[model samples]
Target: MVNGDPSRLAGQCAVVTGGSRGIGLAVARRLLADGAAVSLWARDQAVLEAASGQLAAGARVSCHCVDVSNPDEVSGAADQTRSRFGRVDILVNNAGILGPRAAVGDYPHEAFETVLAVNLTGTFNCCSAIVPEMVRNGYGRVVNVASVVGKDGNPFVSGYAASKAGQIALTKSLAKEVARSGVLVNAVTPSASETEIFGRLDDDRRQKLLANVPMGRFVEPGEIANLVAWLCSPECSFSTGAVFDISGGRASF
Candidate 1:
């Protein structure tokens, strides 16, 4: 749903991590339609290039292949983006990985570590890498993609919940630290969405997962993207450290 307003983000540049698919890709598309130059960052070179190519000619879009979990790679991607677009006005920390789910006592330590590394640490790494430039420019909008599980802890998905909870904390602290510097930091927590992340779950597990939602359905990626685009707009200046929810009717709070 591209807004009729085209100048909302005109001349701005945005970086969307994990933009190859799902919510990230939808966000990138929305931002581009709103007149922002967008760079899509992801781990797969083929997917990244293919997505970039799909954008219509003359669209302000580009692609970078990098692992958000690695600080050096995140920094490299930031460098490449700046090299191409000059400055990034917005950063969407959307790259994430959901590790294995199991009861606390049965869950492997490595699984927990991997989830934390990707979901929590990966968000931190990308933000850290890009904030310097954002600060120097005296303008920035950072949206960390968290989860509702981060707010109300979920069973079996303890590792993911914990990691996203950490992300919420990071978003709040970072927002406070940079509020005076013209950088607004916020987070979006989406409940179970209809995305490929559920591939890790068996049919029974997936069915059970959906039953817990009050809406009894998974959220659409585009719905999450619409919220994110607004948060990244100039109208979002006064807000910082806010955690916006897009969990359908399930997250009434």
Candidate 2:
């Protein structure tokens, strides 16, 4: 349900990675409710199908199952989105993995690599493949999902934190690269949310994490989606290459 007008995004098309569930699904739902044709990209076809049904906007929503870490698959998906929708004006890079919690010296080597491959390199893959079209059109919005840990650094999840920090850096660099092209690139660093990602933390760690937040509550996906929807809209013009924190006052400086 759109809070204000349903035509806010009328005629636009958006691609949201990790759109099958969690914050990605919430953002897709908001974009569609605001009247943008949306393509949901994720690795699980079945989950994507379910998400489409949940959106209930019929042909206005499409689903493409692809791994964000794979450039070939991302290329094919971007091409297909253009073929089906004619353009992609907004892109939300929200796919990420939570690697096993451990000290930097003891973290699983493969797990760290996988996190970077999916969270950092994957964001680069999506932007590289899709932003060229935005450049050609002279209009676009890109919102990369980052994390507060990227800034302050959490104790146990070094890979996740490092990947998000890289994402923030990427947003700055890309925003500059495309600044003159009217393609605004920005990142959102959200605190722990009531999503699957938080489930990765054990009770003790989760409690400690919450203790760091002044709000003492997890963020809701819908709240993050609301911010993303605004960032995706033309109203967000004039802001680029910056980070918006939805961390419940946990971010300072």
Candidate 3:
């Protein structure tokens, strides 16, 4: 569905956090298809290898076992990616976790912290580690994969919603900071998508989420990947510190 010039990103290199599966994997495939060398970063080595095999782009794909929440690991991974590809021109902060589904009163404090650590702080870590180089080079594209629940808060997932909202805020703050540096920072807020994350939900909760999407269906990973490919492309100029909604009409603003 994402038909375009394959060479649009021929000379670029991209890093996708959580690139082993789900949205991150889809984004990696799309970027590779667009001719950008891709480095997949995830915590699971086995899954990362499987994803690398799926891409099947020898010499243009690398896998880094990284915990995005750990600054040292992120720094090391960034160095490895740069070593493999010479430079990183695009970053897709797609790593996140859906904390337990529970009311705020029942939510575990530790779980809340973990969610923020991964979804919000992890995004910060990657940007801090990689964006400075992009700044020096005067060219970059950063896309934070936030969620629609971030804008319109969802019940029973306070931690996840809060983390996503924080990511959106971070996207805007950083985008403005690099607005004139030829680097564009933006976020895509997708509604509930058809991904492994949904396996964590129960029948009733799943139905409730699906019903909230007026489209009456879950968004496809490829659909989200298509949008992300553009955001990471050279043509996505003039849009920085903005949030693009792919929420199936669920985003009111």
Worst lDDT 10-window in candidate 1: 50-59
Q: What TM-score does candidate 2 reach? A: 0.97
lDDT of 3 at 74: 98
Model 2, 49-143: lDDT tens per residue? 99999989898998999999999999999999999999999999999998988998999999999999999999999999999999999999999
Off by over 4 Å in 1: 1-4, 57-59, 200-203
Model 2 residue 223 CA deviation in Å:
0.5
TM-score of 3: 0.97
All models: lDDT? 0.87, 0.94, 0.94
RMSD of each: 1.8, 1.2, 1.2
How would you encode candidate 1's per-residue C-alpha lDDT over 1-253 as one tens digit per residue?
A: 4553568888899999999888888888888878899999998989887777765525588888888788998888888888998889999999888777689999999889888988899999988998878898899999999998898778888889999999999999999999899999999999898687777567887787677687788888878888999899988879999999877655556
Candidate 1: Cα lDDT at 219: 83
In model 2, which runs have C-alpha deviations exceeding 4 angstroms? 2-4, 200-203
lDDT of 3 at 177: 96
Q: How far out, in Å, is residue 77 in model 2?
A: 0.3
TM-score of 1: 0.93
